[model samples]
Target: MLIIPAIDIKEGKCVRLTRGDFNQKKIYLDNPRDMAIIWRKQNAKMLHIVDLDAALTGEMTNFEKIREIVTDLDIPVQVGGGIRSVDAVKRYLDIGVSRVVIGSAAVTDPKLVERLMKIYRPSQIVVGIDAENGIPKIKGWTESSGLKDFDLALRMKSMGIERVIYTDISRDGMMQGFGYESTKRFAERAGMKITASGGVTNAEDMKRLIELQPYGVDSVIIGKALYECNFPCQELWYAFEEGITLDHNFSTARKK
Candidate 1:
C-alpha cells in the first residue's frame, strides 16, 4: 500500500479541519511550500492538496500559489477543490499537476468527468468522493449532496474515471482512524485505484486499509496523524516498502 500525505490549504495557509468542520480548524503552517518541502525531504512520492477556500467558493483562489508549489517541487501533486470545468482541469494539467481531483464537480456537473476523461487519460483524472453517513458532501463538506457515496463512485466509473481519493467527512481530522468500510466498499464497487483519507490516527489504520487490498484500495492519505505528530510517516512508509502486511483490527466494534 502507498502512504500519501495531505496539505489542506485555507486562505493560502496549510490548515487541518477537525471532523471536517470548517469552524474548527487548526493552522499547521503559514507557508504550505515549507510543509511540502518537509514531506519531500522525508521521501514522499506523491502529495495530496485540497484548496478549502476554492471548494466552498467555486473559485480557484489558491491556484497561483498551488501552481508555484507544483512547479517548484519534483514530487507529483494531485490537487482538488472547486474544479468544476474542463478549462479548470486543463489549466491544472497544463501546469503539470499529476492528477486533478473533481469533488463537487462529480455531483453537480458530471458531464465534466466524461469530457475530462476523454481528453486526459484516466490516470490523470481523479474523483474525490467525500461523505458522511454514507451520503456525499460537497462545498468543503459543509453541505450534503444527498447522494450515496458508492452511487457516485459507480457513476465516475461509467465516466471512465479509474482513480479516486475517498475521504469520510465524519472521520476527517478526528484522528480516530479511517472510515474503512465506506472506503473499501467504494473501491470494491468502482473496481479502481483508491487512496483512502480522513482520520488515520496511527499505523494500525494503515494496516487496516492494507488488509482491504483485495477490495481495490491502492493506498491511503495521512493528514492529522502526521501533522499532530501522532504517527511517523517514515514508519508507515517503511512498513509498506518492506511488505509487512499485518492483519487489520477492523472488527465491527472498531468501525464506530
Candidate 2:
C-alpha cells in the first residue's frame, strides 16, 4: 500500500480542521510549499492536497498556491476541492496534476463522472467520498447529501469510475486513527482502488489499512499524524526498506 501525505491548504497555509469543521482548525505551517518539500525529501511518491476554502465556497481560491506546489514537486500530486466543473478539472490537468478528485460533483451530478470518463478515462479522475455516520457529506463535509456512502460507491463504480478516495468526516483531523472497518467494507463493495483518508494517527493505523488490501484499498492519505509528530516519514521509509509490511504484509518498493 502507498502512504500518501496530505497537505490541506486554507488561505495559502497548511492547516487541519477537526471533523472538517472550519471553526476547529489548526495551522501547521505558514507556507505549504515547505511542507511539500519536506514530504518530497522523505521520499513520498505522491502528495494529497485539499483546498479547504475552495471546498467550502466552490471557488478556486488557492489554485495559484497549489500550482506552485505541483510545479515544485518531483512526484505526482493529486488535488481535491471545489472542482465542481469540467473546466476546473481541465485547468488542473493542464497544469500537470496527475489526478483531480471530484467529491460534490460526483454526488450532485452522476452524469459528470460519465462525461469525465469519456474525456479523460477513469484513471485521471478520482471520486472523493466523504461520509459521516455512513451517509455521504458534501460542500466540504458541511452539508449532508442524504446518499448512503457505500451506495454511492456502488453508483460510482457503475459509472465506470475505477478509483475513489474515501474519507471519514467524523475522524478528519481528529488524529484518532482511520475508520478501517468502514473503509474495508467500502472497498469491498466498490472493488476498485480506494485511497483511504482522514483520522490516520500513526504507523499502526497504516498497518490496519494495508491489511485491508483485499478490499481494494491501495493507498492512504495522512495529515495530522505528520503534523503532530506521530509518524515520521523516515521511520516508515525504513520499515518499508526492511520489508516489514503492515496490514497483511504486502511488499512494495521502498521509497528512498
Whole-model Cα lDDT of every candidate shown, in order? 0.84, 0.86
RMSD of each: 6.3, 4.7
Backbone clashes in each candidate structure, one number apiece? 0, 2
Tens-digit lDDT track of model 1 for 90-162: 8999999999999998998888888887789988999999888888888778788888888888888888888
Candidate 1, clashing residue pairs? Answer: none
**Sliding window of 10 residues with minimal summed lDDT for model 1:** 245-254
Q: Runs in model 1 with CA error above 4 Å? A: 242-256
Candidate 2, residue 200: Cα displacement in angstroms equals 1.4
- State model 1's lDDT: 0.84
Candidate 1 clashes: the total is 0
lDDT (10s digit) by residue, model 2, range 1-256: 7778899999999998888888888998999999999988777888999999999898999999999999988899999998998899999999999999999988888888888888997888999999988899998887889988888988888888888899988788888888877887777777888899999888788778778988788788888888788955666755643453343322233322
Residue pairs in clash, model 2: 210-247, 211-247
**Per-prediction TM-score to the true structure, in the order listed:** 0.91, 0.92
Which residue window of length 10 is worst by lDDT in model 2?
Answer: 247-256
